[model samples]
Target chain A: MQVRFWGTRGSLPVAPKAGTIADKVADALVAANGRSFADKAAALAFVEDDLDFATGRSYGGATSCVEVDMGEGPFIVCDLGSGVRELGLDTLRRCAQEGRPKEWHIFLSHLHWDHIMGFPFFVPAFMDGAKIIIHAGHPDAEQALRRQQEEISFPVPFDWLKADIEFRTLETGREYEIGEVTVSVILQHHSHDSYGYRFRDRDGKVAIYSTDSEHKIDQMHDENDFAQFFGHADLVVCDTMYSLADSVSMKEDWGHSSNIVAVDLCHEAKARRLALFHHEPTYSDADIQRMHEETIRYEELTRDTDALEVLCAYDGLCVEL
Target chain B: MASTLEWQVDKRDGGTVVAASGRVDESTATEFAEVLGEHAETAGARLVVDLGGIEYMSSRGLRALTLAHRRGEEAGTKIALARPNETMREILSISRYDMVFPVADTIEEALAS
Candidate 1:
């Protein structure tokens, strides 16, 4: 199975300002230092190998959306944040290019505006024979989504969409089979209550997607209990929307976890690889990189012989297990 | 000693002081919220929570505090914290609850403020 991240930003989507982009260009030019490139290949290699992670690569500004590829199975996606607009377009384009029928399954964490705001713009929904399954923990997920396209807010009504839309209310902790993958969801602590999903393919490869969930070390499940729930998953996508100090203090009860909590939890759970996700909108790529470094240091200091792998989730990051 | 958090209200200078002790976590937050609500029911409950005895407090405890603070504000009953212990003080600073509440040096100063 391959996991693809379409959006990793939290709270809302944001793009680098003109000044920020210009600064990056200037910084890159300064790094070049008036030295002429030997060739296009050499220049590309310089940017790829020599450029700083923060200045060269962007974490991107799209809100939460991820796609999990299970070979020969239907398209599986998580969240409908603004990033889904791109996912929807991309999926439609691929389907048209490959002449594949569109059968999409979307898992929504909650019905918050940022999470559901992309549905109206999902182009496939306007096309006939498009199958869309929305799986969520919220009982009112259908109503909430329908309300978004009510005539007052959007030009198109929910019923007017040509796709065959289905809503599934997932039972907590129940293992479900969607196409070729098995999934289990757990309720997470958030204002509107989000659901975290654990997916496993027939090959037994596990991937966990959990965001917008606040985790407190003292309040979280016991290490053993969490280990059982996580059960040696290959990847656990998590919320690290704040720094340790902020998560513990000013943002406490704001329904977001810190990198510290994510690291500690993943370490205890013994998950193979943990992806720090749902990045705070206010945090620059540099801030996230620093946080990533600090979290790595913290993990190293606290860890025993075995070290848990950690990676910051960025838009377009893909992992195969 | 009780295993759970304890809340005791004492009538102090010009206000009510709710002293919290033990672990204020998920298990005790609901009870804590109820206790704060009882004081908030009164028309003018100038309430100052004393966290000096709190052994441990997590986000659940913080949630209860913020809810009480907002509710108190809506009802015209001021809620503040006086004489928080070192741990609680650190938590308050981190959660920035200090900014939301008037942190006084003593109960007298809290009530006076």
Candidate 2:
């Protein structure tokens, strides 16, 4: 199975300011040392090889959406954040090439705007022969989706969508077979509560998509239980949205966690890899990169067993397990 | 180079001081938290945690301190951390735990404050 991050940012979508882009360009030019590239390919190689990620590329501003590709099956994705728009476009291209029916199994963590805002612009939803089954722990998932598309809020009504859509209420703790994976969810601490999913494929490769969840200092049991849920997974995409101080103090009940807690939980779970997900919207790429570096160091300092590979998820990143 | 954590509680005139040494990590964090909580119950107005001798502290250790801070707040005992080592200080800063508790350069300063 392969997991692709279409959106990694939390709260809202953001694009780098013109000044930020100018700096990246300036930095790249300085590193280039007035050297001229023969072609576009040569320039790309220079950027990919010599320049650092924050300078050459960006951690995109898309929110929440991730795709779990099983090679051949109904499309499986988590969340419908702004990132889903890109996914929808890609799906259209793929479906056109393959001449296949469009079916999407979208597992939502919550119905928050950042997680569902992309649905309105999703091209597949307006196309014929498209089947969208949205699975959520919230029974009112359909209501929330419809409410967002109401005339006052959006120009287009939800009823105008041409595709057939269904809502599946997922019960926590119950395993459901979706395509080739067995999926289970656990209730997470948030405002209206969120759910974290664990997906295990036929080959026993596991991938966990857990975002918008807060692991509190006082909640040791929840941490332990979540660790169990994340146990020995190949990859665990987690919410690392705040600094430990902010998470425990100012943002305690605001429903987000920090890289410190993310590393601790993944370490306790003995998971193979941890993908730092749900980037704090206010942070710049440099800030996210620094947090990623700090998280890797923390994991090394607290190493008790096998080393856990720490990765920072960026838009368009695909990890195969 | 991981050492077992050890702590001593001293009832000072102005505050209760909990002096800790060694590594406060996953193995010792629960006991560390319990000790702080137990001492906080008897603390008068202030509780100072002396981290000068700590060799290493992990997220678990941070959680212990956080819980201690909350406990101190509820019991009307102001909790402060003092003298975290260079590496531990960086950890505290990176994790933003520095803002959660009043960190001092010395136990004397912590108790005085």
Candidate 3:
């Protein structure tokens, strides 16, 4: 199996080139601490100007989407956020290139706008005879899709789509076979109804994906839900939408986990690797890199028992499982 | 003393109905756990928690349920839930608690099994 992250930012889309501003700010901060008062003041002003420019670019986009390819099996795509539009187009290109039919299995974590916003823009769904299977937890799964199709929210109704779409309501912990891969769904705590998924191939390799889960301080001491959900998986793709400081001070109960929490869960579950996903939109590439480094240091200090590898996810990043 | 959250335990044909009311928050989770623990030893039969009247549940509430489930396993009793509301169902689903315990759509279905 191969896993790819098409979109990693959470809540909204992030600017593609905001790293330049972050670099400049880092340089300014470094210079300010090393220089005289006059130089420090000038550096601070430059930093403020760069931040203003960066914020404008970071705030204007959509949410998370990721794609997974199980070798010769079903095309499993997780979350249909704005990233799915690009993924859908990429899928069409891949199918056309490979001379195969367009078939996809989409697993939804929940019906939150940030998670499902890209459903309308998925190009293959507009093509005739394309087959799409949507697996979600809501009892009124079809109605949720139809609600998005309402004339008030979308210009084109869901009826305008030409693809053959089927909605399957999934029960937690029930394992189903899609081609050679066995997929299992687990429930996750979030603002709304959400699910975590585990996929295992015939080779016994497993991957668990979970996002939008809150890791409270108390959860650290208790037997966490993620620990059970991700037990012994080879790879875990998890929510790391906030830094530990940010998560503790501000984003508490916002239904997102910190990178440290993700690492801890990975450690507890004895997962082989951890891919941190659902980055805060405000995090520039440099900020994410810093967070990743800090998470590694924290993991190294706290992870006395497990040999877990951690990776930060970016748009277009891929991992072979 | 069995920690005191309000509960009515009714013996049925082949199972015991444990009807609990009020919010099962962190403060009252111990009481909930004690009730199930006590019932596990005395009932000596299948157990069904009727959660139709439960208005709210936190993670602690889930812990109590997990304790009951584990206790039932140790005691060799079948444990299930009857008539959980949409919110409760969602909580159970996300936490994967539904998988550990049988969830019935109705009391009759729960009792019959």
Candidate 4:
């Protein structure tokens, strides 16, 4: 399976302001100094290889959406945040290029505004021959999506969408076979609550999407159900929207977890890799990089082995297993 | 496992020290507030909170603690958080609550400060 992140920002979506972009440009110029490059390739190489990730790269501004490619089957997507538009548009392009139909199985973490906001803007939802299955742990998932498409909030009504759409309720902790993949979910702590999904493909490869769920160390011990569920997964996408300080002190009960918590949980689970997801909108690229670095440092300090890899989930990042 | 909080109060000569353990999430914040309010009424002189025993605290816990801090200020009692663990210190720093309440390494240190 191959996993790609369409959006990684948490809560609200955000982009670096013009001034921030300008600063990056100014820094790039300073680094170039008085040296002259021969061509665009040379300049591009400088930006790609010479410049630091904090100054040169951004984690994208779109809110949470991820695609899991389950090899020659209907595409499996997690969360329909603002990033779903990109996925929708890409899927349409693919259908046109391949001269065939497409199906989407979208698993929602919760009905929070960010998670449900993308469905309305998904162009394919209005197209003919698009089969869309929305799986959710929340019983009211259909209503929440429909509510957004009401005339008061949107131009197109929910009923006007031409796609064959269906909502299926997932029983948390129960495994369900969807085509070639089997999925299991666990109810997680959030404001309106959320669910974390674990997907195992036909080849026996496991990929877990555990977003928007807050994990409390005081409660979830190393030998708890979560640890067992997360054990030995290839990847665990987690909510790390706050600093350890923020999550505990002021942002407590805010339905978000910290980088430290994610690292600790993934470590205990003995998961192969952990991707920090649901980034705080207010944090700049530099801040996110710092947090990523801190998480790495923390893992190095605490982890018994280098078996577990930690990475930040950025927009357009693809990980193949 | 169930999420619960334990509060142990030991009034010292310099101030009243309260040690907290377990968690302070949405469910237990109300109870934490009630118990803290009861002790705060008589802690006009000073109050020291030992956060070492605390394993977890959430935004609800922050709200409860902030309210207690405000009440102590109104009652003319100095409030300090003592022996905060790494997680607690990070929380306090990110929220900037460390600036609001003095944090010390120990109850005696908090009282002395």
Q: Each candidate's lDDT (Cα)?
A: 0.79, 0.89, 0.74, 0.81
* Off by more than 4 A, model 3: A16-62, A217-224, B1-113
Alpha carbon lDDT of residue A135, candidate 3?
Answer: 88
Expressed as tens digits, the lDDT of each residue in A1-321 for candidate 3 is 788887777887656555666765566556456655467666557555644433322322346787777655457888888889888988888787876458889888888888888899999889898999998877676787778979999998999999999999889757898755788887776876688889888888898889887765445434456687788988899998865544544566788876756776677678889987888887765566766676666566545476788887777778998
DockQ of each: 0.05, 0.60, 0.02, 0.10
Query: Which lDDT tens digits does candidate 2 get at residues A207-308?
Result: 999999998778765688998999999999999999888887777798998888888888889999999999999999998998999898888877777999
Candidate 3, A182: how far from true, in Å? 0.9
**TM-score, chain A, candidate 3:** 0.83
What is the C-alpha lDDT profile of model 4 across A1-321, one tens digit per residue?
988999899989898889999998888889888778999999889989888877777889999999987656677899999999999998778677865358889999999999989999898899888899999999999999999999999999999999999999999757999856899999898888899999898888888898888765344432257777898889999988987656655676788887766776677678999999999898998888988887776666556555679989999999998
Clashing pairs in 3: A13-A61, A13-A62, A187-B94, A188-B94
lDDT of 1 at A201: 93
Worst 10 residues of 1 chain A by lDDT: A217-226
TM-score to native of every candidate shown: 0.74, 0.94, 0.64, 0.78
- For the predicted complex of model 1, DockQ is 0.05
lDDT of 1 by residue, A38-117 (tens): 89899878788888767778889899999988755578999998888888888887787866569999999888887888
Q: What is the lDDT of residue B48 in candidate 4?
A: 83
Candidate 4: residue pairs that collide: A245-B90, A245-B91, A252-B58, A252-B59, A253-B59
- Compare the candidates by DockQ and give the number of the best one: 2
Give the CA lDDT, 0 to 100, for residue A95 in model 4.
72
Which pairs, if any, clash in model 2? A245-B96
Candidate 4 achieves a global lDDT of: 0.81
